[model samples]
Target: MSALQEELILSSPYQEFEREEWKDLNGQFNLNLESTDIHSLHALNEPLNMKEIEEIYFPLAHLIELHIKNHDTIRDDSNSFFQRNQQKLPFIVGIAGSVAVGKSTTARVLTKVLSLLPHKPKVELVTTDGFLFSNKVLLEKNIMNRKGFPESYDTKKLLHFLSAIKSGIPQISVPMYSHLEYDILEDEEQKIIEPDILILEGINVLQVTSQKGQNNKVFVSDFFDFSIYVDALEKDIISWYVNRFESLRATAFQNPTSYFHKYADMSLLESREMATQIWNEINKPNLHDNILPTKYRADLILQKGSDHFVESIKVRKI
Candidate 1:
């Protein structure tokens, strides 16, 4: 085993279980159970199956639970010494990955599984998509083509949201964005109050910017208690993106009010070409420049095969 792999195994809570044995244990868990499959929580149209949940997300949720318990104990001990009544901060998990790598599915599954845990009934999942610049702002900047790039998001607002959650604010409201409308709804927001675990899933959640001549300030990563990078081969991801775009063209994009409605009438070949152009010009570049570089920094890495199935997991040793 590589030194990094050895370190990961040693630090992981499930280190005692052999890989095969762990898979068996995970297989025993029926993800289809009424309590386990949360339809309301899923952001995507497709429903995740039990095997996918077991093979990929169950272990991750278990790790998060362990981290939360340990963090609470440490906080209590420190508070006891200081003789104060400060509540422990919520355990924040950052999920990062390239576009169309099934990260949204992974995030949703984690949210569902974590909430199912008896110890943590209140689990909130927030996507950084909400922090993206409004369509008006993007149009004004004339960078709508760079929608998923690092500069497309309002980093300051995202940082403040993380800060508030870290500070243990009683009630935190996060703005909601609609892909169909291609805009963030000003009035609608998701309310998270006293959540035991907070999952912040985004493409650039782990990005770190170094200011010249100053102590490096870790951006969103500083607030993360645990981080995960959902990974797959570049070619596979591109294929998935094109497939997803084709699927959306027939469905969401067909809506009269949808921003991408114009593409709905295009032929399959034309749609594929458009998808390829967008992926090559926008998403691929952003993934290479901003997202892939942060993969090594994750606490756990979930590696997926071409079929969108997680083949292996690598947890970083602390």
Candidate 2:
């Protein structure tokens, strides 16, 4: 056995399941998803199909529904014990992963499935991209190159938003981010209104970040009732990132207003070289330094194959 497998068996707090094993756990029926809906949920270069939903995400959605039920039960028990009628907080689900690892597709698919639960619960999906500093802010901070790094986010704002959600605040407005423009839209906001479950997806979701003078030791994951980390071999992730960049060059980057429009006219070789350089200089270091370290901290980890499909799942033992 590999040392990694041995270590997992010996001391890891997680129980691992191969893809087939995980699929067997999907004892669910009447999933209200169509091929059209599935297609709309996938991000650039990330494929989603009914087979994937049936074999992977259906079980995951059912598991999350179980968690939400438990969360409600606990709240009710706590209220009874305390003799206080406090409002129940939304069950926050955090999804974390490296760039181009299909976190967006996972979040969207899960959101759609959960909304169609037997209870027809309200499910809202939010990405931390909306919390990232705009191009202007990054340039002013002289960290434009560190775009996806922990430091490039408005940590205070994100925390405040999470706090509001847990506080049961209604109609919370989140900053809007445009992938085509590659920046935050100052005038636009996404309203999250009293969802029964909120899925927060981002590379930074599971990270341990603190403000310079933060007295409160609360981390982002503290707001999450359940957390997921999408994981893969670094080599595979780098290839995916490069491939996604190339795809964007052909599609989104061709727009004159795109932040990466300069690369749209580049030859195939030039685009590939640029993507590799960005990955090696920026995304790669961020993954190793900030994202990958938080993998074990997640309640669940989805290990992906080179083909960008989940190969295994590791669930933290309760």
Candidate 3:
């Protein structure tokens, strides 16, 4: 068989669209987000420009709005059929990707866009960093180097919190995490109070974890109304991570309170070498073994180019 035939047979279940094709769907929507808004929503050291937002995220937000409208209609019909009224639960959107892939920026942009819709629904953004095992716990368990892997998280607690949200609990409080400290804040929590939409952003949000001999556990993605996976080639991601590492050394890592402050004192060459080593030894393995495996489970996948622009989108084929 020809190589082209083999490639065709290996095509994904997702319906792929190039950037031009996807952005054309944004059509007459007044790209109302200003330059300042895009800058504020963007991540530090990530190249997210106004053009990228308008061409990529604006159309995605519009698509999500359509999905929410259809969901509401179906929900109303179900309620009417039962002759009963039930409290509306927030539509949960899970954003998953490799480290340095810009999932946080994507989540922030989506939250702002959804909240600014015609109905102006309440929107809240939460990250799964809070769901991770505290630094103390990791040290005790001797898994400090494996931090972003699934085993380093409090999976049961995360599951419980998500379950409460979907069960229509009036308010839920999640532990807060501090990037400056690179640890969970034992004394602080973020309260999410009855939002109209909840955007859960994290590296492992779409991952499925199960023991080798156990088959009874459900995954975190089961509760998601929608899920997004931010994707890029591994080589591009390594470059991005190294760039971010250097930037953080000059900025946040300089803070005495920063967990990575040790790197702040290192020379430029040393820092770059350490950054590449860490990425190769730790982050790359996690992406290959844990994160990338979950990409097909996403409702939508944003595939980014080496230049940090979203170049394609793959919506799961229903």
Candidate 4:
């Protein structure tokens, strides 16, 4: 490819914002979150300070609020045009990223802030982890090593769940996944009852899984009113994964009931090596071949620097 072709290929339909510029967009809105609340929101090894909340997430929350309002307005207009009373569906937001990229914290903080908006919207969070096939099923399929891959997920069930929610069904129940147990909690379920907004976070929420020649194909993202992708360099993500693994080795992994309990006996260096090996073999491949390709599909992208703080944001121009 020539230089012109390369430039065109690299160009994106996004308006980029530096951290300082983005903070200004928050305006005079007061986020009523206390220090304790902020502390509670941080994921393992993911540093989220008030500075980040104020500068990065506050603006993001503001933008999502606008989208929600717009959705409501459009719904009202459509209902009036059709001369019918239509039930208002929940506004769904999807957050996607690679493992250890901090998308979970983003989803949690966004849910908290969006719920605290002036309208006090009821926000519910659901992770795609719940949709993963059980270990027994994976073993039967011989795809245990590809646990986070698309094939490991029950796409039909996930679609049904999202479809039921979109159809304005009440009292929808979703299975819950336990990180400690490393499997679905068969007895525990999350009840979502007519939430004003639903935030779905996972590594593959933005992925496209439809096969060719399939009529009326629907994807998980088709349910999203807005979407975000948390992004970072591969090296930084590997470092974060290793750091989190080491931290968990000293904590969650030590639990005898934990699926990763064996790792708890490993030394710091050994844990790091194991983490790196896992990332290289599993997460990295998934990130590059599956997750990263969907980054551009997000309505917004939060780009993190080596220090793990969001350095800039990219909003889709169209």
- Scored by lDDT, the top model is 4
Off by over 4 Å in 1: 1-21, 24-32, 35-47, 210-218
Using TM-score, give the best candidate's number. 2
| TM-scores for candidates 1 onward, in order | 0.88, 0.95, 0.94, 0.95
Q: How many clashes show up per model?
A: 0, 0, 0, 0
lDDT of 2 at 303: 96
lDDT of 4 by residue, 1-318 (tens): 999977874686888899989999996666668889998888998888888888888888888888888898999999999999899999999999999999989988888888888889999999999999999899998989999998888888999999999999988999999999999999999999999999999999998855333443789999899999999998899889999999999999999999999898998889989998999899989999889999999999999998889999999985
- For candidate 4, the 10 contiguous residues with the lowest summed lDDT are 208-217
Q: Over the stretch 1-318, how does candidate 1's per-residue lDDT look in tens digits?
A: 999998976666532333445566443334454643555544443345666667556766666777888898989998999999888788899999999998888887788788877654688889999999998999998979889887788877888998998887889889899988988988899998988889999999998965234354658899999999989999998988898899999999999999899999999999999999999898988999999999988888888788777777776655
lDDT of 3: 0.89
Q: Cα deviation in Å at residue 42, candidate 4?
A: 0.9
For model 2, state the Cα shift of residue 103 in Å.
0.6
Candidate 2, residue 208: lDDT: 74
lDDT of each: 0.81, 0.89, 0.89, 0.90
In model 4, which regions exceed 4 Å deviation? 1-11, 211-216
Q: Candidate 4: deviation at residue 205, Å? A: 0.8
Clashing pairs in 4: none
In the order shown, what is each candidate's alpha-carbon RMSD? 3.8, 1.7, 2.0, 2.4
